[model samples]
Target: MTQKKPTSRRQFLGQTAAIASASLVPFGALSSRVSAQSPNERPRFALIGVGGNGTRTAPVGQQFADLVALCDVDAKHLAHGNGLLCDGKADLYGDYREVLAQDDIDIVQISAPDHWHTKILIEAMLAGKDAYCEKPLTLTIDEGKLIRKVQKQTGRVVQVGTQQRSSMNFFNKALAVIADGRLGKLYKITVGIDAGGWSPEISVADVPEGLDWDRWLGPTPVMPFRYLQDPKKDTDRNYTNGHTHFRWWYEHSGGKLTDWGAHHIDIAMLGIAAAGQNNDPVSVGGSSRHDVEFKDGVPMQDNRYNTAREFDLIVDFADRDVQINIRHDVDNGILFEGERGRIFVNRGKLVGKPIEDVATKPLPKDAIAKVYRDMPIMGNDRDAHWANFTHSIKHRTLPISDVHSHMKMLNVCHLAGISCRLDRTIHWDQTTEQITGDELAASMMSRPYREGYEIEM
Candidate 1:
């Protein structure tokens, strides 16, 4: 590793002036002070899971780091992602472990399925690499704990792919207004996620030619391949889309609860945190209706999707004053209802009288910067998340979406899924971090991994 030179007096004064102007929080406790690297010394990056989301994030990684390797369970996906790189020059691999085995890669991007996230993230950190993992960071509540433990042990930089954290318009602006007390007293938060449980009826068929199905199903139970052909092109044998369709299954994902819940729930928790409320919910209860019948939490029909089609969940915080209601029927977004006024935010827009009032009654000058943990507000720029991750790796600082807060938010999503699955109210002991009373509900917190794929501490 190259050692960075000492900062000049002029550079220190400039940094001091920037911090003073932004009204930024002191970074002494939030992150470590490591030597910053030069632009010419860009880190080497290896990307795993070149499916839809993976393909999208690859170019972003290219913008900050050298694209050294691309890995995917499907050969066609790997080839496609590699082609998107600068002159298609990076090496390609069918297995992610092979990419991690290399000593030169400094950053690993895990954009795989929800089930594979924890395993890859842990292995990447253990291999001495910083990571940028997509959200719904873990498949279960237990996985989140394990990832945090490993991250602490390794001291590696990890940025969860909850891009909203870096967005200036929706999340940043919303938090700024809330923190400024524009919305007098936040009483309730409503999050609406997309409805799930649509799986076309299909028969068992052979795995496609270019895909390594077993590897793709890493950590998931071994099951027969269910053929899913594109409705538009009936004869298309390529099951690329089908391979990534695991999100609809409970075994692989928590449906829309974790899918969109990861994003909305995160912002909800951030709002709660900004308002000086405990981020973790103490009690969660919900009811769900699935397209297929579930027996002992497993769907009866394996041929079609099993996750809930419609559901409503109510969450109570330790603060007692704040309550969260999650539903499937409403449009996909978050609504924060407070004593003074309410605001609604999603990927597209952030609106409400409170937000509108900011024109005449602007936030307390540095409120936006404060919401971003003292960083400058980069409005509507999607690349800010990637930039933050890379900047953290270079400076050894905590990015906006650090692992600890991400896990806390994910816990709420997982609890909601478990409650909806059992159709009962579940009590949670936040101090102990366990589900109370119902042993069956408690068991859902973590899952038994397949023999070779279990997450080892």
Candidate 2:
């Protein structure tokens, strides 16, 4: 890891500087069509960005839909996905646009990097395909706006890949206590998403064979491909910039802010909303520690991972008298604290007196069900999310993890990034979804799209 030790653990400062889609058609000008799929009818699916997540979720999507196409910018990735989902039988392509052109594909399941999700999803919706995108959905706050707008206009059933929403009885059970007011007016949600890793420096190299480097850049600025030899091994096969570690780079991702923050902060908002509390934050401010020095929120180094390795932010939803403290020093998961009691929940278990009391003093029969948004508990984890997506497609209903709700939670994450990058608190207007009075912070909202790859509408 190429990281320098932090000079001070407690530092408060103020400085600011900061900060996809596709389409042949404008969403406003296009006529949308959505046919209700029969309960048993298998919706055809296209798996884009067939890397680790694409391979994982794409096969799961097959449980509810047929894999009609697999797309990736790299040929090896496409082949890897082909090996996983189909026995080299499904049609494969290097460009996602080609997958959207296939009229038979009904659902485009995206497991792409955060940077590519918006562009692929907007294009898929415009091409008349429902989508299931990976969590943390957007690379920036404005991307969320674009996605929500296009989704509303196209009437597409877009499900974000936030599986924790249905992780067995863990979150649902924990959230039920809050919704039932058993926590006695919860005041804070502390989400500990661990921390980001300081990456070893990577060296620039020529693009590898079978990769459409230009197309892969898509809306991102074109940059030289970078690769690093695995320190523990003697191979340069793993690219620090592309297939595996893009999340660590700020240009391609929001770092850990949007990575794990996408998952934890989401559940925090769900608990807030389920408890009938306002979920939008009024202001966001915090301190963060990064290996690379930042100038006006921009990282100084380009060859190594630059995201925050440690951070603590306060997302104050003043209207509800609640605050979310997102930090790296605590255990990974969410903690709900209030006057009466507190409970902790993660993939492992839901703990605390509230959870234990549920055995003797059981919550209402519909308590956890309500947390499930009244949707019947499907399977578990990713399977449950996929099931819900298919059910919503058939029933013309919203999946549990809808884009609007996801973006709502994601806003907190992006704001945290703003505060971390700038080293100061930024006020937020929940209604307009704007960072008020900070030109540098506001500039972080949307990024420049490369020419010939700009998003339409």
Candidate 3:
């Protein structure tokens, strides 16, 4: 649990750089890589889902690991990554399974859609590859459970890209306020994640050339490609409902709930822990706005964005006497109100009476460290998040955004999404991590994968 803070960005990079240049060291006798590789050799990584974020991640990943392969179902995206991220030399594939098949790949970085995250990550670990995956690590509550099981079985190191926890000093500082008792008995958390983008009527369109529409819809049901032509260029992908536009559909993602929720909501749970409390909610219920009508959480129409465009969810922790309201109208930050005082934080700034009082009333020196569970803030968010992952790969320890904590918070987000879909309050038996009372609601916790793509849990 103890980690030394890197003195400088240069020093951190130098240490990470050693992973690639250093001589091979024993990863373990049990590793499949025993003959061909070691734990110390620069991990050869396969980047999956090369979209906008994947392109941005490539350069950062290369600073610590080698990018030897890339995969994306859309040929256009694959080409973009090939030219820009890999300079056309990394072996490219349309199927991620193929990339995982390569013997040389020791690591995987997944930026795939939320629906695909669990399957890919579980397989990567079972295949003996450690990985780093983007946030909202699971599409459903069951998915998170399945992933936790696999992680424990495989003993693979994985990190979730919930950057706010790493990059935003303000966020951790806000958690410190509670840990330091600047906030007297914490009572409520108001999270303003805002709303998802709205889309107009989408028309069925021919699948774009070089894109495998089938594979892109991997685990979701087969549906026609739908899109709205660019208003200006007549070539945009804005409302396509796949590729760049999948987040708008409940079939692919939880919209802003998981999109931004994975970031802020995850921090909110840590804030719960900072208050010396557990985060299991006894009841989750809320109202949400969908562009289309719904019957039992299933959208009645297909042409419009179906995920909640706007929502307000209430998560109650009855045992702890705490409540969290995830709303669209709150300022786009977490407003933590306690009996003593209040402080608000997002990626930008941390403020309020508690923060102001900090000038004179310094927080407990170990407050932030306690919330982060002892990992020293390395450098910038980018430096620390990545550094923590690479450091874990070398030390064979869990990274900062380890699967366990990430999934625990993510389950709350998934539960909220289910509540939005069903339009009713659902009780949770936190002891079993199961939905209680409503069978229909309980069923929504996990979806049956389209036949061929089923995950082996």
Candidate 4:
């Protein structure tokens, strides 16, 4: 069905001033329907992949939005989540497309596997729904560009679930320091993600019962499930039952690159002020170390998580030298190295330079708004990412981590992963958004989807 297109970004902003001028409308009024009508009766939303992140955030969404639907490939997860639905009246579906078909669902929260992100997001926007998708936005480099195009065409308010953007003490302070030149000529950035173990290779086996294996492997190539087996310990175990083991496989995910990189590198992208504004790395290269594997391993249980145990990737930025690395037990955090000084920021701790220096350093009132055009302001207190999304839905404004901006950030991770695989330096074309010189390596940017799952413009 053809959807009613949203007003252009410029047109929507133009109406905002007039609405504020009206004595009846509030300055930050969000609803498009205007006052005189009850704004509480707003849009309905749905949750897809209600297992890990979705299950946790489902109740919170219901408080702000009408949770009318739930979808998941796993029946167990769906049944469990359905029981907790507010008023216990939400519609449940196994297929995501079924939920997307509903006309009343004005918004959707996608917490599906990495491989399914681009497909479901693009289709949802085409069907007239705003999306809140988890980060490490795309599985491949090209997918990033394509997703951006569809988001622009549909004019949807999409928020990539990189909640750091909503934090004042974390992201806002980091952005403030960098843009104000407190870091002074920002020379290098170091990002580290802690996944905590080595990955051993594994052998393939048969598909198990009670699981829609093919459907779970949507858009990814069919491969024998690999199970992990420890030598000298006789017994066997299965690790392919859920999404926990998904990050190690290249079929559906990009190991740590998309997993932890989605978080840590996302911060690096924000700090360097390159998250939304840039695309196409001028150069890419990295090295990785993988675990060893034996032939006689348990079925579908392979030590073969495809992620590298230790990795380092360097992407040549236009002005600065940017780098992302994966280390064991270093924890997930970002470090910004500048000519003047350095600072390290993470979830639990924020330290760098000196307290007196950082405390005294203040960005001018117009600084934040000036560096990022229409970037979300993380008021004094952080932890408002989800609230920002709900507000944007009502306000007809795009969230801070919108798809267009997210695609650019995701490309950095994609290039980092590709570089690790190649283990050598490669040149890139910014305009065409393709790798130069090496045809075989360039082809690796995006793999062909399996039958019935290909995404096209």
* Candidate 3 segments whose C-alpha is farther than 4 A from its true place: 1-40, 230-237
Which candidate achieves the best TM-score against the true structure?
Answer: 2
**TM-score of decoy 2:** 0.90
Poorest stretch of ten by lDDT in candidate 2 = 10-19
lDDT of 3 at 335: 90
Query: Mind giving the per-residue lDDT tens digits that candidate 4 earns over 9-118?
Result: 35433443332233232223333321122665766888988777787766656666777788887777776777766445678777777776666677898988888899
In the range 1-457, model 3's lDDT, one tens digit per residue, is 1112223434433433443233233333234342245646676888998998788776788988889888888888877788887778888877776666565778899998878999889877766778989987988898888888767666678889887777647887888888888887778999999988788898999998998988888888999998677686655536788776788888999888889888888878788878877677788898887788988879999888888888888898854678889998778989988888888998789999989998998977877777776876676576678877877776677788988888778888888888888889888887899999999999899888998887633
- State the weakest 10-residue window (summed lDDT) of model 4: 292-301
Ranking by TM-score: 2, 3, 1, 4
How many steric clashes does model 4 contain?
11
Overall lDDT per candidate, in order of appearance? 0.80, 0.80, 0.80, 0.66
Residue 234 CA error for candidate 4 (Å)? Answer: 16
| Model 2 lDDT per residue over 5-92, tens place | 2222122011000002333343334332335444456678888888888887887888887887887888888777777778878887
